[model samples]
Target: MPVEEHDPFEDQFASALRQAGGTFESHRLDLAARGETRGRKIRRRRAAIAGGVTGVALVGLGGALVLPGIQTDGGRRHSVAGSPSAPPTPAASPTRPSAMSADDVVRTLERLLPKGKFSGEEGRGTGEQLPPYARVVYDDGKGKAAVAVMVDRVRPGGSQALETTACPDKVFVPYDACTSGRLADGSTLMILQGYEYPDRRVDTKLWSAELVTPKGQHISVQEWNAPAEKGAPVSRSRPPLSPDQLKMLAGAAAWRSVADAIPADPRVPTAEPSRSQGVPGGSVSATLATLLPKGAEVVKKGVADPGFGYVVIDDGKGASMVQVNVQADMSGLANQLFGSGSRTLPDGTRVATHQGPGDKGGRGVVMWTVDTMRPDGRRVVISAFNSGTQHTPATREAPALTPKQMETIATSERWFSRD
Candidate 1:
């Protein structure tokens, strides 16, 4: 049976959540069920909370994860069982590495953490159905918190590696602070202080550190103010670990050995170049900037991504966020995305408009959208939010651009130009 196509608006909304590290587990299940019907995977790293619908090539602790380009082929590793309190040490020889057991993975995390009482411990070691992870509910005297860590690998200098370290745009992600830099050992590290919910509906704070070594060791550490990532009361004003502590935990050397023991995915060739499979995000943002209505001051812009771009604008009324997605060969989805309300242009183009409440749980937020498709199956979707981000309360009565203005921007010939 063919998988039914999802509503395009929902997909775009979920993409924003994924990039912002917002929780949307149902979306993940939907994407899994849809399977290959979804085209190329756009990977993202979640430093704090995890959710949103995208191809999660790797799993991480506390549901927070790193995104790699290709899916693992479920390769197996030789597991040597050990005690949770005292995991078996790997052999000295890198040539003859010993696999860590699930217990070993958990024990390593426990040992590296500061003095704390640990419970609800769980872990997946190398050769598991999913990637390796270790999570525990830790109480460091002040409060009980959830701390998790995951180790994986990515292609060195690949798009996955770069994305893992890049700071998310505040226009999409409402983080308090974020920093990314290279270490003395050529490792890239990023620490993010953000909320578990993009909307800040709850005050649960989330902080995380991501470290990618020169040899492709991908480590992510996440901690939340509550005992769990979600569905829990905030146990403290902030997460248990400070930014520096999170960084130290992620940079621990023990994880690299665990990464080494994990077997490689047979499907992802090692030499694959780190390039986008869609229209470069820089091109989209540049084009969108050029098409903005006169005198609209650009407050912020999104990171250079492929096929997606966003900008925050304030036309004197208040801050508003405008985002666009440029996709090629989307004709297969036209019938599902467009309906009777859509109209056809004289040049064989299709146009659809929508005005509705924001789907991301922000209070009093509205979304205005213009979706367009050319005869050649190229898709350009433009959406504006009343708030600077979809997850925030409305800052104005409506989006900066009226529906007609959005339509004009969506249909402009400037979008058709080559990057």
Candidate 2:
């Protein structure tokens, strides 16, 4: 199913979350689900990477997952098992020489599987600019099921390592159960039982194993209830592999060897942020407090989120929430963002105002928003929610503030103080 892209403000918000480890339901726009009919997703939670839907193609930790230009990109790495020392080909080739060739990776997966009819194999050798992935259909006679393995690299140690295995905030990435642990070799691994749909609205079961070796190689294994990630009907009550099987597959030494062969970008010397790039959440909240209307009672606030912040307020009119985000250098997206419903100020600022249902679909919850950008492409967006959350019934008929009030906040000059 083709997902529509979100508005510019939302695009900035989602990008902030992705970059800062804050969580939001994937704008879902442009998410490639491969196959399936999708209605507007309700209670959607985001996967850490969006993983880009159908099957996650591994990119390293921190910043920029590829956008899909071709639909139906799957790693059908089907290579016949060959000797370990086979001569290699180009990086994009399904089979490339590594500690294990593409066929070696495929054969290793088959050997690891519990007895069954194995066919429809696919995998990539260590040679690709893209990560190496192995996929197979395994049938224990119940039905054909999909099992996949992807190997890449990650930053070793600290939050970056844990984030690779940590479950997403439940509010954004709902899952049944998840656990993280240390292997005997000191590697970090996490197993999660989740649904194909973020809301668990569907019965398609998805179970995954995420592991980061002490040396920073990342091996991710995902198994599904059907033969495909999306567009396929459930073939079983659960995926073919159990948690232990998944752990063994992702933790396989052979995948680590493949990861070792994959080249690293010489341009990026380290894996973590060189310095924090986001504004302190405290400053944002205090700044927002100054701009709020009188008679507002501040409820709670946090200072960890870099580029975004939120404040819940009450004025005896019931509880309403407000959020704002600031982004810089967005000039390139002007044409795609500023069109009808948008007007320009003499100062060369573009402003767009909108009133609509909350993005999360809280019952009777309305959202009043203002989006603005200076000619330099510095953007500010402010939105007011009628209810604390979209999933709940509204306490007020409309957002606490009017669109014009939000417009004032969004267009304020003080926001430029950050840059």
Which lDDT values do the candidates have, in the order given?
0.65, 0.58
State, as a TM-score between 0 and 1, how close model 2 is to the true structure.
0.65
State residue 331's C-alpha deviation in candidate 2, in Å.
3.9
Q: Looking at model 2, which ten-residue stretch has the lowest summed lDDT?
A: 34-43
Top model by lDDT, which number?
Answer: 1
- TM-score winner: 1
Pairs that clash in candidate 1: 281-305
Minimal lDDT window, size 10, model 1: 34-43
Off by over 4 Å in 1: 1-96, 269-282, 303-306, 359-362
How many Å off is the CA of 72 in candidate 1? Answer: 22
Q: Which segments of candidate 2 are over 4 A away from where they belong?
A: 1-101, 141-143, 158-162, 267-277, 280-303, 309-324, 332-336, 344-349, 354-369, 374-377, 382-402, 408-419
Over 1-419, each residue of candidate 1 has an lDDT whose tens digit, in order, gives 00111122222222223222323332232221121111111113332113211233221101223332222223212122332312344454656357777679889989999999998776667654334667778998999998888777777897667777767655455679999999999999988898776667789887888788998888878888999877899999999899999989999989998888866544445564333223543566667888999978998876555566678899999998887776666666677567778999999889988787764463788877788888887777788878886666889999999888888888887666654
Give the Cα RMSD of candidate 2: 8.6
Q: Candidate 2, residues 1-419: lDDT per residue as tens digits? A: 11111211211122122222322222221121110111112111122212222222211111234322112234453222342322344354344343445566677778877899887777655543244556777898988887767666666884445666765434234468888889999998888887766434457777888888888887777787887666678999988888888888888777787777765544333645432322433365567777888888887553444455567788888888777766665565565556787889989998877676664322566767677778987767676777654334577877778887887887777766654
